[model samples]
Target: MPSTDDLKLRIEAAIPGSSAAVTDLTGTGDHFRATVVAPEFAELSRIEQHRRVYAVFGADIGGPIHALSLVTKAEA
Candidate 1:
């Protein structure tokens, strides 16, 4: 049961120069929605950007994290 702040911190730490706003969609700590902005995403495709974020969590994505919905953007 990860907190929103924890998820945000993990995403930011995993992706250098990135910021994440994470919300616990169900208040259960299993589902989340994250909007992340990063300079690194500027060159990557949407799928690639998502993959980068998801890679940070690995197996925990399905085990403890349940589902993570994402909206990613390149830094402007």
Candidate 2:
């Protein structure tokens, strides 16, 4: 089964120096919640920050991965 490792790697690749925490919201691969902190997020608005992370998966938002509740912040 595809695990968080795959998602983590993808996010890490999409945004370098980023750290993420993934939670299975429904015990299914679709619904998820992620807290992502990255140095690259500095100066970005909250909505923009979330968009950047969401864009990583492209159209997979409603496919392999479904709902992604994001808590994104710039790294301190």
Compute each candidate's TM-score over C-alphas.
0.96, 0.89
All candidates: CA RMSD in angstroms?
Answer: 0.8, 1.4
**Best candidate, TM-score:** 1
User: How far in Å is the alpha carbon of 44 misplaced in model 1?
Assistant: 0.2
lDDT of 1 at 25: 96
Error of 1 at 30 (Å): 0.2
Quote the RMSD, in angstroms, for model 2. Answer: 1.4
**Candidate 1 clashes between residue pairs 3 or more apart in a chain or in different chains:** none
Write out the backbone clash pairs for model 2. none
For all candidates in order, the CA lDDT equals 0.95, 0.84
Residue-level lDDT tens digits of model 2 in 1-76: 3467777778888898999888788887778888899997897999899999999989888878868889998974
Model 2 alpha-carbon drift over 4 Å, by segment: none
State residue 6's C-alpha deviation in candidate 2, in Å.
1.5
Candidate 1 local distance difference test against the native: 0.95
For candidate 2, the per-residue lDDT at 24 reads 81
lDDT of 2 at 70: 92
